[model samples]
Target chain A: MSAEMVHTVSPDGPFTSISLAIESAKNGDIIEVNSGTYNEHVIVDKTLNLVGINQPKIDGGGKGTVVLIKAPDVTFKGFHVSGSGESLSVEDTGIVLDSAQGSIIEDNSLDDVLFGIYLKKSSGTIIRNNNIVGKDLPIAVRGDGIRLWYSSDTKILNNTITRARDLVMWWSGDTLVKGNKIEKGRYGLHYMYSNNNVFEDNLFSENYVGGFLMYSNNIKFQNNIFARNQGPATGYGIGFKDLDDIVAKENLFVDNRIGLYMDNSPHSVDSWNTLEDNVIAFNDIGISFMPSIERNIIVSNSFVDNAEQVEVRGGGTLAGNNWFTNGRGNYWSDYVGYDENNDGIGEIPYKSESLFESLIDSYPNLRVFVFSPVAQAIELASDAFPVIKPEPKVTDNYPLMNYKIPQRYEAEEKGFSYKLFVVSLLMVLIPSISYVFIKRKI
Target chain B: MDTKNILLIMKKEAGESLKNRWFVLYTICFSALALLVLLFSTMGGDIAGYSGFGRTAASLINLVLLFIPLIAIITGGVSISNERENGTLPYLLSHPISKNEIFVGKFLGLLITIWFSILLGFGLAGVGVAIIGQQGDISGYLLTVLLSALLAACFLSIGFLVSVYSGKASKAIGISVFLWLFFIILGDLGIMGTTVAMDLGIKQVFALALLNPTEVFKVASVLVLSPRFEILGPVGVYAIRTFGQQGVFYLLFSILIFWTLIPLGYGYLVFTRLRREEK
Candidate 1:
């Protein structure tokens, strides 16, 4: 066994092949691949440091996965991997770390890869700073960006994944996915039957769906941005379905069709989520909740200029949800009520009512009337006659008169500047008055 | 300048128009049409017994924009022209009142008649809706009535313009109908079609929307009533930006008041100058 020996492998080096370098190397040995293209699919069977110098290319010639790490404590880095076989059944991946504990796969560029980096039963592995872009094909043919199956206590960080299907975690627990920019994919981050995951500071933009935590619990999404994740039928910034014990704080969801969509979340009697200080603006529906979503406390957030501030889907109720915490409610752009006493809280409650939202819970066909005059009339009528209206979709008893979404979110917002608006208003009015006067004087 | 003379003239003009049997018929017609609009909404919806008030009021906005201006113009268009043709204009001028007084009195009288028709039409519909179903939006209903009255006043001024300028009632009425057709239907379509064919920007289209008095009413009325008007996208955004929440109220009110006053002023100027020239 070559202990602490450095085997340099290149296309023109003495040990020209990476597999040969690995065969000659021992556990804890280093094999550095220099610049050039290697066409064979390599398997790291020993626990060694397989680092790429000058960014060497590992081409699988459109065959199987380019790199498969089966050993414990293997460190792979800085390789350009491409040309994995296009087979959904085979779960063809550009890189695979199977039960590779204490491993690191960092700063690698994976192109034309089906499954970018698949972690199967791998624990304590760090996958950071990797750029994984899928082939230019239809979404059905594309595979997962980074799929973690039965992988526990993993750190997936700072990876830019685009055109790949989903950054998914299934049956994985205690995962930390942070600082990743996921764009133009199906779901930016999707969790199913996973628990105790924390996704922080990640940007999920232009994906078909931003993120969804399904059948998962004890998740925390902190300070993330979900923007422009639009679809033909369903565009969600973040969705929670049948989950429990979630905390989403200081997140920003902007310009999505549906910003925060929750269904059957906080499922149990004792289950709850604490969402605070988030900024949700300019989405089609700022927050849409399914009926029967209970015990969720959402407070100190700002919902600005959405088509409908809040909506309830499937004719159900958001029971037991606390709109205000500690006497502080979210700021809404459409709230006409003000705090006459100058205490920052509105004197009247802010009602989240829209014609389509009010009716779509019962008649899905009413969604077609969204933003129509008919829907507007119905919404106004519902507000006037509470008896005819269904239960309040979402009411903020202590709504903030001004947006308290923090200064960071304001930079992203095309805020309606009161001063500029007043000036533009004056500019519009002066001409009208003059026109009236001039015509009359004639 | 004389309130007593203006009131006396206003009372006589009001009495003559109010006594007409068509006032009651118009009021009844408005009530039935408003009810039909509400019923259409109810039939379209499957939720509760009645659709929401905002939906009804919003739809009624379109209805009000269409019919009120036409009705007001027809009713007022015949006023001065009919009086002039019947030799009553010379008789009325033989009195001690000024031309301004007669004009103001007739304008106020026509505005009142228009208001009466609107209130009666909408009041009956409001009562009917309240009685049959729950009151969807009483404030919205009232706002509709108020906006509709303003709209009627705006067109009545236009009618007065046609009336004072024309030599006969038939010509005045024809001009009023043409004005109605232009403002209510073809104005928007022509401008929109031309702009689209010319590939004009949203700003141009928005500017064109502000050109017609009725179009201004249409934008402002719906803009104030429903935030859903934001769905108009870029052009709507530009319009909303130009006139913010409170600005829209002022802008539309100014436009309506302008529509009401400017035409009467122009007509008064023409009438007094023509009579002076004849003398």
Candidate 2:
């Protein structure tokens, strides 16, 4: 297919068009590019395919990587790469893949880049369906939208990262991160000392600190969602610092901010993690177990609403099949509780833990008046005068109510279509201009 | 002006506060709070016997009412603006003393180096609670370190009246660190915005948080460490039963003797109005 090996970049080609089609390509050459705006910075080094055709964009003329593959079976399809380098300690990229290998970075879009698809020391990569969009703050060129350093067998699929400060997979290993969506990030799926990973159906919303797992281990999270990660002060939705043999199941965690913050981790296996069939409406604390956490397993979860749900500081072992909607049998929209055998499971079991979470597990800034309503009326008068509930383990006898209720996910109806098209165009032009002034004053 | 020239001007102002480096950084932050209460009481009885001694005397009375008014407003805002920015107060006002013996020898050498750094940080926090607390109570850590060193000598006499009306020494250490963060974080965020605009009434939120001196030093250090927690409702039990106990010890000893006599009588009337405007 020699038209000079199908080169063709825009405005009548050759102003170093895609670096002269990677200096006149060969190993399965294809270039293409065409639709306009190509400020510069190409660098592919061989085993070609570069094809952009209609979405062609490249930019970074503001000096910083826009595309720097280095070589191996490369394939950056449908490009859009934007400006790079904001310096979170430099390593700018829009589509870097240094020390490349069998690459196939698909459907690209990256905007203000520090990194959109970086993969240094690259491996058998497949960073699919990219759409990254960063910039919220601390960006002295800090990036990472689909990063994979010290790479391995990768597959990060269905990407759509937003405001990324980190969507990484460092010290990478066998990765397979599935169905990603990740929003406003500070960390939505950060993987440190990595190993056998496999996060499935990822969503991880409004991040400031969601999905972080340091000192990584044999990972395997399933059916992920993890909503509204409120932040700026050690925020967390699914954090597992100093991690180990991890294995979370049927994950959901709604209204997060310590919805699953386990520190100094140990042999973990939090089974059937179906947390309160989540839509966790408002959070301050739902699940937090610190103090060098140990041999874990908190089965079939659900601890509704959260203003103090389940905080078991230092020392773990809360047996199988969990559920506590907060009233008598979990459903605390501030539970009043009394369901005389209508059997929706409210014959009394709701303790919902608090005494300022046992005085912040023996004082950790007694959580600055733990959201004082006079400290929630002294933790609801010490839950009607009972000194301790620190050891009441009940794991759901019959819990379930509404398992996965969030089905409005096209980015939340595309963020409510401009407020539902300005409230349906003012409800049909204010009732059709008041019936056309009462039929033109008939 | 006599008692042997005010004891030879308080022994040369205690030999320039024992060669001060802010009294050796307040004796190494009171020996690092007595080595963190002797490593949280020798980590025995599993960490201070899991919060005993009235929650470790209410967390050391909130770290001594938040760092003894920040070490008495940074040692009374650099005592007289670093002796008039190192001119050394005009050679200690041209000796032969007597401006009441150089204001009682620089207020007894800054009140004996701030009461000997609060009794060596409460005798090394009572030898770290008698070497790691849990023998029930060391009388609530000796009445919260003697009422937090008498409320850090009434905030070092209101930071020696803002370092004698601040005329540099970096404006008396930036107006005593913004008047100790405006009485500790905008006086508890203006008493939590007047207890959410007076709705959460506990006698108008304890009469507007007892006109905030950090809520009267946290309700007099939780009424001297839990005199059985009815914890001040009814306007903190009517402002401590209408200021009893000899009228709250004569209103905190007349606000610490009017911050040690109105900044040494207005710095001896501004050094006799600058020596009658230099004659």
Candidate 3:
């Protein structure tokens, strides 16, 4: 083959439009697009390298997909793509790769687009260092930030997506999602029927649901931070459904409604899910499990200050799951047992047997009385009368007695404010001074 | 009608309140309790895993809910009945002041005393929180203070009504304590039991809860502390859907104000009729 040629596309170049340059180039040629707006939909049918100088703009003119890749080994980078059509049915996107394998899309900014970057049957694609923002539409109407359908072996790295629906992967296996920050969206990562995916160092905040994994297996979530996903209906840090061999370790679930929601997970009889060393704190409920969920081992996790630590939906005991593995169990904030041996584990087993909490699990509407005197009264009465105390929901034989606050949460605590100190002092001093002055007048 | 007479009576009432041994004892005890609760709740820092200001503020709300009404009701319950028992009401009625002046002056004076004690107690506790507690938003704490004062005023109005109609000071005190129990304990339990047993609808439960001033206070405090009142669950969602966030807050606030004003107004009318009968 001849040496690969370089085609230039600029406002005053031989080829004014990117599509014209692409049509004139061969399969392995490089098209260098200069800094100018190209308002045309460019389709690449052969393998080519499209490089943008000074981040040239590719405006879709509010039409269909801006760039369509139909060949393998395509490299597209350093461009601002915007103004795709706003039809969800049509799947208008900033860039859509169709059956394109071994493609690299990087260092691009997408805005006002329906779907940011979509891959369909595109394997071995790398989407990295890109910023994606959806069109200014309601959450239900907005399109996915990045979606992969039947696209396996894709690596999504160091991307920021905001105000989009979700970063979704359907039937995409062996994918790696890392170092992504997704905020204010519906779901940060929505995975279904994907296997062997690794999610590491991703931060999802202020979204409706942080990560929803369903019908997926062998997924690992490590060192991910899910915070403030307090949606009205379902604010879950991470939800697991009908999955097996999942490992979630060293993750932080904070300030969400339900930290980890499980429903018939580990569906296969021989499979077991593992959740270890995760800090679930300050959520409305630490973990919510379906009545019949089993075959899971939850250990060494810190369940801290959640209003309800573990709630079994529809009012069934959590007897099926194992709370301790290898003589080590989770740390619970409400454990009243003593550590007689000082072995870092409570001598008495930590049991969730709150009568009121059990009642609330059965009838969620009773949650309206949370923190009310009636709730306190029920607790007091149950303590006074053990007969009314229901069976233990779950028991940890070797519950950890002490837990160090995670480094990230500790760093989030700003030091004591002197301004608040002054205000508090004034709140006291003003009343005292006024009282003294009035006393003297009297 | 006379501002000077009202001020004079207010001054006398405030002076008497400050000098009374029981009042002084109650004030010291409340302040010390507030300080202790704050200290205990925030003792171990991060190792204990307390959620900083949010948890401390929740503790303060509970303490205020249980304590403030008791103090206000006791103080206002005896204000008029004790004077009546001592023949001081008749003696004061013979003075140049109208009955309205005495009633309004007494209410304002006791309100000042209650507000001062509560603010001072929580202020001292707040200072401790500011010094050692974990750093988070203290706006919840400030909201607690403001709402506790409103709660105290509401109960004080109820106490005034009890004091006006009771035949004896002891009777007034007994009635005040009973009212406290009814609102704080029995009434809430009844609402919960009835809602569960009768399977009452959400609107009925909401209305029943608002009927008690303390429940209104509790709802308002939770609304401020939890975002979208998520902690309250379905009731909170219903409230948000029925009345937007600000709407629910203002509605609860107006209900508290009504709790304060109606009882105060009714007590004033009763006291006026008593004066006319005396004449």
Candidate 4:
């Protein structure tokens, strides 16, 4: 057997380019490339290690994929990759692992690329600690930061992605996405036909949607923060469609148009989903469910200060979904029920029954009067006259009496603004002093 | 128009309005309510969890919408009818002041009275919020105050129209109360009925909402709080899109200005013609 060798690629070395070094190396050889701009596309078809000594630059010259790894057990890291082609149809990428398995891609910075990393038919891959910025095009025209197609058992960790269309996974299963911060994109994480996936501690903000999981089943999401994904049409912190057997726990959904939007989740009649111990707060609508959504256990969550807490689209009640489990229910900010006998559960059930809100669910145009005195009057009148009270959209018999804010949102408390203080004081003093002066003069 | 006569009547009306019992009571009630809204908005931070200027401003806007127009209409509706019923209008007309001066002077005086009370209410509440060290949006609060004062002026103009049309104070009060109920309930019914009956689009709903001054006030206040129109649902989004952010403010202001001018102008023409007929 031949001994594995280390080949050097430098301006002054035997091989001046990375492709030349790869050509000169064996199947399991190491190619160490020094810090220099290589303005050519390179393809590695053998098992090799490509290590950038001082973070070398791979400039694609706005052409095709900068680096294509077609072999398994390839290690590519410590490089700045840029200048990929702009054609979305051709799927230009900074790094492409085609049918490659067990590859490690880490510590790379990719910018001005259509797709930052494309994993096609690759499994058991680890993509870690990369900063990916997509091309400066229209959001529709922009490509994804990391795209996994037909790839399974991949781990994506701690990568910062921005200004891309989406970090998408298609037909990928058993993927672990953790500690990633995604902002200013279309969909932060777009999942489709993926199963047995786990997402934890991801921060998705300022995108059209934080994460949308569609189809496939048995996914778990925990401690993920979805915030400020306020698109006009699809501003959802997280959404589920045709999904089954999902568990989302201890997640924070805040400041989105709709905190959690569900449509036909737990699709099979025997399947069920669980959403527990989440904080859904300050959104326009919290936990908007489609009419046919059923068989979901939603308990021990905090629904705080949402404009509308439990809205059933298409004008039907959420009686199919269970709001309480084992005498435990979610904490609702607008819950008017009392807890007698020193129990944590409220004696009177928490019922979401606002006549105006129900009308709005049926007729969306009535939302024009939201936050107006007319809406308040309708609610007050309904409270005064129970005969006019509409049926409850949701009922939690053992509603929890207390909620603790998650630490992630608790850390964002802003300090006092002295400017506001001074202005308010002025607002008070100027009017009072002027009123007195005007009266005395009169 | 005699400038000296107008100024003299304005001062006399202002002095009288300042001494009125209802005016004083509304001032106190509005301030107390504003303070309570501010306090509750901040205190609910532990429960509902969001406390800041935005929440306070929204609650204050509702409080202003419910009370400001009622106070303005009641006070302004009876301004002329009370004088006419007590024979003071004839007495004042007997003076050198022309009818034009008296009309403009009364409107300006009553507007100032409304402005004073609104200022005091928002101001005291602002001070309480500030001293408590709660975070708030000062500019938004100020804009709400400005919008509230404009709303008061618009209702005052409508009230003046009612004052001139009605002969007795009791009739004026009845008309004012009825108009108040109509405007408040109009927003609810207009949206509910049109949407339920016809399923009108957002553009049509916004057009209908613009017809009512109360709706305009509510929309403008929401815009101030959330410029992105996130909380207002589709109507706010439509408004922001049709008129740009700055354009919505201008549009609302012009609508309110139109509301104020048309009624006041018609009221002036009718009041002057009626006085001539009486003479």
Comparing 1 and 3 by TM-score, which wins? 3
Off by over 4 Å in 4: A1-16, A33-36, B19-24, B44-56, B234-247, B276-278
True contacts kept of 3: 0.47
Residue-wise C-alpha lDDT for candidate 3, range A1-442, written one tens digit per residue: 8999999999998899999998889999999999989899989998999999999999999999998999999999999999899899999999999999999999999998999999999999999999998888989899999999999999999999999999999999999999999999999989899999999999998899998989989999898999889887889998998989999998888878999999889999999999998988877889999898998999999987777899898777777788998899999988989888788999999988888788778767667777666677788899999999988888999999986555655544547868668767887887688778768878
TM-score of the first chain of model 3: 0.97
Where does the lowest 10-residue lDDT sum fall in candidate 3 chain B?
B44-53
The full ranking of all candidates by DockQ, starting with the best, is 3, 4, 1, 2
What is the clash tally of candidate 2? Answer: 15
Better of 1 and 4 by lDDT: 4
Q: What is the RMSD, in Å, between candidate 4 and the native fold over all Cα?
A: 2.6
**Model with the higher lDDT, candidate 2 or 4:** 4
lDDT of 3 by residue, B31-89 (tens): 78888877775653242122534555666677778889998998889989988888888
State candidate 1's TM-score.
0.62
DockQ of all models, two decimals each = 0.03, 0.01, 0.50, 0.48
Q: TM for chain B in all models?
A: 0.93, 0.34, 0.94, 0.95
Query: Candidate 2: deviation at residue A52, Å?
Result: 12
1 or 3, greater by lDDT: 3
Q: Which candidate is the best by DockQ?
A: 3
lDDT of 4: 0.86
Question: Model 3, chain B: what is the TM-score?
Answer: 0.94
